[model samples]
Target chain A: MIDLSDLSKSFGGTPALTSTRLKIAPGELVCLLGPSGCGKSTLLRLISGLIPPDTGRILLDGQDMTQTPANRRPTAMVFQSHALWPHMTVARNVGFGLRVRGLPRSEIAAKTEAALEMVGLRGFDRRLPSELSGGQAQRVALARCLVVAPKVLLMDEPFSALDAHLRKSLREELKALQRRLGLTTIFVTHDQEEAMELADRIVVMKKGAIEQEDTPSGLYACPATLSVAQFIGQMNVTLATARDGCVAWGGRRIEMPVSGDLTLACRPEDLLPDPQGVPAEVIRITDLGPLLRVALMTPQGEALTWLTPRAAAPLPGARIRLWPRALHVFRGETLLETIQPQRLTLEEDA
Target chain B: MRRFPLGGLTLLTAMVLAMLGPVVTVVLWAFAVKWRYPQILPTEWGLKFWAEVLSRQTITGPVLTSLALASVATTAAALICWPAAFAFARLRFPGRQLLLFSFIAAQAVPKFALFLSIAVIFLQLGLVGTFPGVALVQGLSAMLVMIWIPTAAFRAIPPALEEAAFDLGASRLRVFLAVTLPQAMPALAASYVLAFVAVLFEVDSGLLIGAPKVTTMPLTLMTLSAQVVVQDAAVLCVMIWLPCFVLLLLTRRFMTSRGIAEGLGA
Candidate 1:
């Protein structure tokens, strides 16, 4: 387990990471998910002892490891670029840490082979990093860190180097390996789907600070902030007046919190065509392989998107009534209420 | 310039040949037994002067001295430059670019001018005509190379490779030895060759700093060229060019591993 207490860092008088607190469990895979310059990499570097934190205490397995050098700590990182020593062969790269520990040659040799085997590269011991394909080299890099049997594994966008298909397969393969090893891992990536697929919990970071931290589904369904709602997925938010735990927008009322300056936010998937709902003119329906992304303009001139079956979407310029199955109400950045479909049914009954 | 497709190519070839012109002249001079200033080619050629230069103990001493001094200078410069280059490449300082520029500028300034000014101190310290002093003086002329080329080479090494080594629990020293140094090897090799060749061919520093007592190969060749027998200087030139020719042949394989170049660009 690692406890980051009040961890903050600044580069050139500009804050890279704000005072942040987080607890990572022993065997949990947590992804620091964010776009570029969001301090995800900064936090990882601080934890790995690559850079000194401006202020913080990092407690690793109940020890104050903030001052400990990266070498002394039972932690290892697989770099984003896979950073394999260009000169060393696959076996030697895997055995590097053991060699540093001054382990006997035989032991290092045996373990290196085992590590190569573990990463499914048993015959790749003699190959230099340049000889390996992108996927092969990535495995070798993984084997290199895993050979040391580190307590925590930090991966910084390891799959970002590969093509789409390779990225997906390697992602699954790495996820399986992480589970099998039962290692506490901190994976960093900007790709939301990759985070959702791999991480047990995703920490959404923005502007050097975490916006929200939760399970993928939880974050998707219950985004606490307007940015979180918009960042997590395609969310359509419209200005609405809240009254008596309900929001009035587009001639229809959402049963939610009462506020003067509340905004109704709903994911593209949550918006569905209904006979008795707010009116909209379908602008275009784009085929998105699994679903058609329906583009619409409401009577109030609010642009909206809804993912529906190709057959379900009305043709362009056709009028359709739509209902938000769930509406997340946010006043400024704060989420006020989550009005479900039952509230709409209850409002209909009333 | 781009109006004609082959115009740029012709210009580039002319520039390359212009640079190689003196080198080609030296090679031709090495074989020329009887060549006058008015004539373009030598009237005659023979290996007789080669045997005479090789047989002479006076000529061989400076040849050996030149070899020894170049080796010592190369080693010393490498020791000084490795960490210096690493620091300049990896670390951030207020005046890094300025300092790098100043050092690189050291290469352009003639060493004879610098040596002349520093000779007073060397004379006072009783190191003026000594082998160590001469070699050390020769090293200063090539200091920019010892720092600059390797600095570029080490800079070409990705910082991530070192970080990965550290992440795997290797100490700073181990990272330098096992990871960083190896990555910079090709560049270092190329730089070492350059430094060695630079020291070997240095002319004025030996006369300015190591005059009277010490004799270097370039100095010996200079004196040989001043002699009555023109063929003797030609033979000495061949002797000087031979080893460097072999070194150049070996250089291609080392330079082909452009890992450092790619790393720096990245």
Candidate 2:
């Protein structure tokens, strides 16, 4: 368990993270997800005691660790760069923390070997960091942190340096490992897909402030703000006027579940081809293997994207009737609610 | 490859002779028992001057003095410069660049002029003719090498490694000894050997600050050469050159794999 209360940090008079507050439950894997310079890494450093917060308190299970130095805190960090000591062989690198703790040499060796085995690197104890591949080096870094048996783990974009295929496999392995160990983790990353795949709860940050925090599905289904919606996945947003529970768009009036002028957004997959819906010109088509994406432009010049099975995809320049299967209504920047469209049996009058 | 590159080979041979000729001549002189004009080589070779050097205090005392001075000065410089080098490499403070440049600029001014001025200061401080005075001057001359190379080596270590050590519960000093120092050891050792050799052979500071009281090997060799004592000078030259050559070879053996040049360049 961890609690960060009103934590703020600044570098050279520039605020990296503002007065931020977060609490994580025990054995929960929380992700700090954001674009670069959004203060995700700063938050992780504040928690790890690598950098002192400008003003706040950090509590681990009700113990105030705000004044504790990194070495004195019951936390470990896996850096994005791996950070294994180049001069030490893999065994020494993994056993360094135990050695620092003044553990017996035989015990240190046994624990180090077990930790390496946990990371699936059993026979790599004698290899220097330079001798291992990128992924192996990362596993050794992980083993080093795990050997210390800290109360919490802090990983700052640990897999960002790997190739895409390697990153995915490592991400899955890390998630499985964290679940098995039941380790409380604070993972910082700019990768949305990684956060979606690995986080129990994703805390989306923007401009050094928490934008939204929710489960991966909750974030995708109902984003708190327009930016959160845009960040989590592809969103098709357009403005429309709502009056008396009816919405007007693209020279056609459609019945709505909500009233008042609002910005509307829908997922591409949620926009279905309907007989009695707004007409748009298909301007481009994208092949996505199993699915095809149709980019359409309304007569009013509003752009919309629709995903359909490749076999049912309309050709470019074709006119298609588009209807929202579900609509997310927003007033300014905040999402109001999601509405399911009712099937209409009206005849086409165009 | 086809022609055996005779032209290149001839040029290389000339360069090697140019470099080794004086050294070979001095080594022969140190062992020559009887040689005169028009002799292509030493007519008779023996250890006569070696025996003379071993027996005479003029040679033996300077050798001991030189070794002691080099050890003291190099240790003192390393102790003073190491923390300064780490600060230069890691910390951001006002006037850091200016301070680092001052260390380099101190080496650029002609040593004789600088030592002359320092000697004046030493006289006022009542430090002249003292071993500490000589050691201080030698340490000052060695600072550029001591600070620059180690600073570069320290800078080359990823800061994340230190942070990781801290995250794994290593105290600052523990992290330094276990991680930072070992990684930078090769470059640091190379610089130490180089600084020791440079101080051992230093003549200007010795003449200005240590003329009568502190007689180093180079100062003695300078005296022998001025007096035209060829065999004694040659013997002293070989003695001075031997430690430097041996230490350099040892340093090279270790540094070849560690990339000390990369550390310095970094």
Candidate 3:
């Protein structure tokens, strides 16, 4: 288990991480998801002991490892660029840690071969990093880190350099590899889709603080803030005056159990075309193979997007109505309200 | 319509002739037994001057002494420049620019002005008339140029390589030894060759501080040329040129195989 307590770091008097606390269970794959420059890499570096925190205590397996150097720590990092030593051969690069630990040459050779095979780089022992393709070099880098058998593996956008197809393939490969190794991993990425796909639990970050931390599905289905909803996926929010279990928007009053200046949010897929629903005009239609994205403008000029089957094509100037099962409501900038699916049905019945 | 009228083939021929002209002249003169100033070519050619110069103890000892001094000085300069170059390339500190500029500035100043003061210092230290003092002076003079070339080479290495080494559980020293130094080998070789050539021709300090006892090949050649006629001086100059010729040949082979010239822009 890895634990961070009141972790804070500053660079030249500007704070990067501010009293952040986190815990990862053994064999957990937790991803730190945030925008660029949001201190996700900084947190990973602090855990790896590449840099020390100005004020914090890092505990690994109940032992304080705050003062330990990076090489001494039982943590390894796969950098975004996959920083492989270009001078050494593949086998030598993989066996570097063993050599540093003064292991016998024969033993290092055996272990290096095994590690190479594990990363699917067998028979590439003699090739230098420069001779390998980017993906091959990345695999060599992964082999180098894994051969050390580190307790915690930290990856900072390890697949960001690959093409979309390769990135998908590598993500699955990495997930399976992590499971087989049973090593606790902290993955950092600015890409939300990648975070949702890979992480058992995602920690959403904004402005150097954790906005929310939950299972990927939970964070996607029930975002706690406007920023979280906005960041995770495309969300349409409508301003509504909420009072007395009723929300008013676009000259139509809907049943909602929220008070104050609330905002309504519904996923595009959940908003379906219905004969008896809120009146809207299709301002634009975008066909996206399996799903069609229809941009709707209410009579009051409020805009919302709804996903429908491509077969059910809606003309650009067509009039329509949309009834989404679930909706989220927020007051001001905070997610202060949630409207369950039954409320929408009750409003339809009334 | 063209920039210069010298065609490529003409330029190539001219460059080759210019390089070979002085070397062929020296070799021919060293073999010639007798030659007058008005003569375009030698009347007689023999090994008589070569034998005479080789047989003489005076010419031979100074030649040996100069070789020993240059070898020791070049080796010492390489050693001193390696770490200094590494530091200048990698680290950030106060006065770094100033320190580097001071090294370059030392190269620009006339050596004669410093030679008088260096001689006094060497006399006070009782290091005058010694080979070590002369070699030390030569090494110090060549240190800046040697270090600057390799420093630029070391700086060209990607910082990612060293960081990668450290990430893979290598210590800082191990990273330099395993990764950094190998990449800088071509530059290091170039620096050594340049330093060797610089030390070989170093005569000002050797003449000033080394006076009567510590005689280098250049100084010996100077005295022999003055006492004897121009032909004898040219013969001595030819004799002196032999070691430099061997060094140049060896360095050419080394540089070509290692691609040091292309790598370091030599």
Candidate 4:
């Protein structure tokens, strides 16, 4: 287990990470997800001890490792660029940490070979880093870090440099390795899809502070803030007026427990076609094979997107009504409530 | 079967003649015993002058002194500037750009003029006509290569490599030794060789600071060319050029590395 408490850092008086605390269970892989300049990388660097935090305590298991140097702490970081020593052969690179620890030569060699086998590069020990392909080089980097048997493994967008196909394969392989090793790992990436696929829980960072931290489905289902809702997935929000447990938009009213200036937010897929719903005209339709992304403009000039099954998608220029299956009620950037409405019966639609 | 490229052939010939013409003339002069005016080649050729120049104490002493001066100056320049180069490459401090510019600007000034001013300072400090004074002056000429090439080489190494070493449980010093230094070695070696050759051929500092008591190879060669026999002077020139040519040949690969081209801003 690794625990970070009250971590904060600034570069040249501009805060890169504000006060933040996080805890990761042993064997859990938590991804720090955010766009560039959102402090995700800074947070990762702070945890790895590459840079000191202005105020924080980093605890590994129960030990206070805040003052320990990066090398003294039981943590290893795999960089986005692989950071392989170009001069060293794969075997030598993998055995470097053990050599630093003054282990017996035979033991170092044995552990290096085992690491190579684990990363599935068994016969590639003698090749220099320049001789390897991109994926192979990253595998060697992984093996180099794994050989040390670090208590915590930190990866900073390790697969971001590779092509998409290789990135997916490597992500799966890394996830499998993380599970097998049961090491507390923190991976940083800006790609939400990658974070969703790899992380046990994703920590979404924004503007030097964590915006939200939750399981993938939970975050998608119940976003605590409006920005979190907008960032996680494609969401459509339209202005509405609320009064006495009712929200009204586009001359249609939904009975919900809310009052004051409101915003109705829902994912594109949640907007269902229904006769007794808010009316809009389809501006465009994009075919994505199984689903159609329908662009609509409400009467009040509010634009929205609806993801519907291809067979049920209306043509462009067609007037249609959309019933939000689940609506997130936001009052001034705060999610007030998530209201789920039941499907209308056939008789009611008629 | 294929027609030769007339333009390329002419350019190649011109380059070969332009570059090799002086060396070939020097070699002939070193070997010739007698050659009359208007004669295309020497009437007699032998190693007589080579033996005479080799046997002379004046020639051999200056040759040994030049070698020592070049070696010491180049080594000392490297020792002083490598850490400075590393700092310039890695650290962000006030006046860093100004300091780096000063190093580059040091080489741009006419060397003799610069050495003349430095000689005056050396005279005030009682360092004139001393080996240390000559070495110090020669070492100044070496500073550009010793600093620039190693600085560029150190900069070219991604910081991630060092950080990776640190993350893998190596201390700061160990990371530098095992990771950073080895990566920069090729450029460092190239710079050392280049500086050594430059110092070896350097004349102004040897003339300005080591005069009266200390005479180097370039200084001796300059003196010989002025009044000594042409054959003896040519022999000394060939002796000076040989080591430089061989050293460059040995370090050619390193010279081709990015550090040299980038450091020189080529």
Question: Each candidate: what lDDT?
Answer: 0.84, 0.88, 0.82, 0.87
- The numbered model that scores best in lDDT is 2
Model 4 residue pairs with clashes: none
The pairs that clash in candidate 2 are: none
Task: Record all residue pairs in model 3 with backbone atoms less than 3 Å apart, i.e. clashing.
Answer: none
Please provide, for model 1 over A1-350, each residue's C-alpha lDDT reduced to its tens digit, 9 standing for 90 to 100. 99999999999999999999999999999999999999999999888888989898999889999999888888889888889887777887889889888899899999999999988999889888999998998899899989999999999988898899999999999899999999999999999989999999999999999999999999998998998888888888788776676666566665554658887788888877678877888898889988999888887778989898766757899988888888888899999778774425322311
Best-matching candidate per TM-score:
4
DockQ of each: 0.49, 0.46, 0.29, 0.50
For TM-score, candidate 1 versus 3, the one ahead is 1
Between prediction 1 and prediction 2, the one with superior TM-score is: 1
| TM-score of chain A, cand. 4 | 0.92
Q: Model 4's DockQ? A: 0.50
**Per-residue lDDT over B77-192 for candidate 3, one digit per residue giving the tens place of the 0 to 100 score:** 88888889999998998999999999978888889887778888999998888888898898888798788998998999887666656766777777677777767876777778
**Location of the lowest summed lDDT over 10 successive residues in candidate 2 chain B:** B257-266
Q: Cα deviation in Å at residue A17, candidate 4?
A: 1.2
Per-residue alpha-carbon lDDT of model 4 for A46-93, expressed as tens digits? 878889989988998789988888898888988999998877778988
| Candidate 4 local lDDT, B1-266, one digit each (tens) | 99989999999999999999999999899999998789999999999999999999999999999999999999999999999999999999999999999988988999989999999999999899999999999888999999999999999999999999998888888888788887787888889998998898888887889988998888788889998489999999898888888888877654433343224211
User: lDDT value for candidate 3?
Assistant: 0.82
In candidate 2, stretches whose alpha carbon ends up further than 4 angstroms from where it belongs are A239-251, A254-262, A281-284, A316-319, A341-350, B1-49, B226-232, B254-266
Candidates arranged by lDDT, highest first: 2, 4, 1, 3
Give the runs in model 4 whose Cα sits over 4 Å from its true position.
A243-245, A279-283, A287-290, A313-319, A341-350, B1-13, B32-46, B227-229, B254-266
